[model samples]
Target: DQVMIISESDVKSLLTLQDAIHLTEKAYSELNAAQSMIFPAVREEIKEYQGIFGIKSSYLIAKKYIGLKAGGFWLGNAAKGKMNHQSTMMLFDAESGEPLCALSANYLTAVRTGAAGAVAAKSLARKDSKIIGIIGAGTQARTQLEGLLATFPVEQVLIYGKTEGKEELLAKEIIEKGYSAAICPSPQELAGQSDIIVTTTPSYAPVLHTSWVKDGAHINAIGSDTRGKRELVIDRKPDKMVCDLWVQSSIMGEFQHGITREELYAEIGEIVNNNKKGRENEGEITLFDSTGLSVQDLEVASFVYEAFKSKFV
Candidate 1:
């Protein structure tokens, strides 16, 4: 049997934010339906490297596949003209335990990650949400915008970044993408104007304060994947909050740093499957504490692999 190796270019060509969002939603629904399983994620801090190494593995029962993606952040690679993220996914046949395909997973990781935010926003955010506020004007900031556009008819986007020079750069990219976009001077301004807010920065201290977030706004806390990293400060409790995984979110996510299990309403999967209610009232603050998930990577990888096989064979 010939092993199929998928490149980043091939994956990017085959995958779109819309497809990723749709597939990821299905993945969450399957997870909530007990048709999928994600093993506990492993994240280790590489002190000398000043980054993180992680492993996410999962089993998709209905899809009859098992897979794992191993990679991590190398913070300085971008300056050296390499991707900061190095990830590869290996998919195996569930019954035979045979390797089926190997794929470059960095782009897969990004789109799937963005789709989780879209899933949360669609499941929990108010239906009338029109403005998207982005914190941390990086690749994630753009990806989040792409994902949201697929889910919501977003009218405008406001970007807030910690870095000085990158502000105009991200805003330009957003506008060039044919969206009404501009740079906001502060996170406070962005949050105040936005009906949906997404934070995508690696900051130790709180970049978003509860006071800045307007009532009835939805926030996706994306950056605080590891312990001690936080983007949003919970000075005032949100009305409803959910995470991808309760165990990981409680210990390694932003919840562990400032909030507790008692504060979170439910997992996003639970909300997606209608196991629990999402956004009972429009006038309440909603939050999704996303630490990212192995199932997400597995779902996208599996979808891409199937497509590759169909096209090639």
Candidate 2:
């Protein structure tokens, strides 16, 4: 009857990018295999606070895990010396319908999202992709870069951000990590130079244009998880389009703007499950539209909970 409480420090110490990537891939596979069920996500805008609150929940049938993550973007948190994105997750014993654990999820959210993008990029991007471009310089963008570095032999990183000093700071961090990094004047420039591109901005309008993306580029559009948010401007359909989940992304993800379900090649999980093809050739343009998934949150939270128990219980 005692619910385990895991803090942000515990999650940070226990979960690594590599672990998140593996868990995210597993979660996707489970969902694709019909072993997991993700309930409809709820996102609401707190107009007075200029923030967004969302809830994502899921049940893993095979693993017997059930959980929900509640959190959102608080625009004013930065001024308060806090992260803009904040959330918490609660795990439950599906069999007994009892609460099992509560976890801080800000860091979890970043790594898992990066892992989701990496999972898609691994299957869709060309094997030789070395130059990566990031569209935002926030926590999510940094983690996305970290995830790509773990998956690809990246040689250079290009970043573009609306904020002046943020991109520079991120570039410096990447340089210190032993990679060549630079700031681009525009998203178009970044896209033209990168073999793999990740867009993590919370933009209501398109930040990247279709014509800017070069052939053989793989784009991970992870910012638009709400009904009105968008990042990519795709006038012409991509050579291949993949997403985390068709049910959610079709309505709220980057594809929600103009792309249809018919245009989507397959979900990332289907690609992982070998039910559908990924990148067919090197010159094809590939896009991964991620709205994030509750399964990802649940799986990673469950992992953190287990790790905590094994060590501290």
Candidate 3:
């Protein structure tokens, strides 16, 4: 098995935020058509290490490939001059079950997660929505904004971060990029001012309240991907809610223990394939629970493999 090694820098150069968004949509569309299968993720917390670790895997029938992405997030890594999130991807031939390639998956994770939120915003949010509120200042925050900016004609932006300096820097970066942006005092202020909100904080409890949100607001709940973690406080069920996959979202996504099957509007795949409705009314508040999918990683890896083969092989 000739394992083609694709490095981190290669991934960064090959997959732009726009490329991520487009390919992720294709993955979801194929999944909706019953052409893909995503296995359960194995995630765990290690108190001694002060980090989280997991393995995500998927199979794509249309592409004739299978793969797994394994990595972890270390809270102490920043002090070591490293990133918090790291991942590695391995691809296999679906028929022969032979290893085909290996890839760096951190950028894949960020972009796919960001694209997942952006896809939700495009499908569910108001078509003319302009203002966006960001609730995290981490690396994923930038990609989430980039994905949204690519999809919508944004006019203004609001952001809330724990550290003032970091939040200000993010605001400055956006402003320097020629966007109208600011750092809000709190999640409440950001929620109130934004037409669409993207929450990427790793808070265990709810960080934003529905009371602060306005009518017709759309929310991409991206932070809480595990049970007992949440970024939005949904005292009652949201008017409309969607997820990448109902099975995973109900168990480990932002919805976690809350939200019943009756409350879920549809999976993102269903909406993308037009098999179900997205947002039915302009006045309805919509929420998307993005539990990053394994198929997304596999999809991107396969896409890059082709590109790499054509260029380097």
User: Which candidate number maximizes TM-score?
Assistant: 2
Per-residue lDDT of 133 in model 3 = 95
Encode model 2's per-residue lDDT on 76-133: one tens digit a residue. Answer: 8877988999999999989988999999999999999989988899999998899999
Give each model's clash number.
Answer: 0, 0, 0
lDDT by residue (tens digit), candidate 1, 7-76: 9999998898888988888888888788999887888988887778988899999788999999877777
Regions more than 4 Å wrong, model 2: none
Please report the candidate that would top lDDT against the real structure. 2
RMSD of 2: 0.9
- Cα deviation at 7, candidate 1, in Å, is 0.3
Q: Where is model 1 more than 4 Å wrong at Cα?
A: none
TM-scores for all candidates: the values are 0.95, 0.98, 0.96
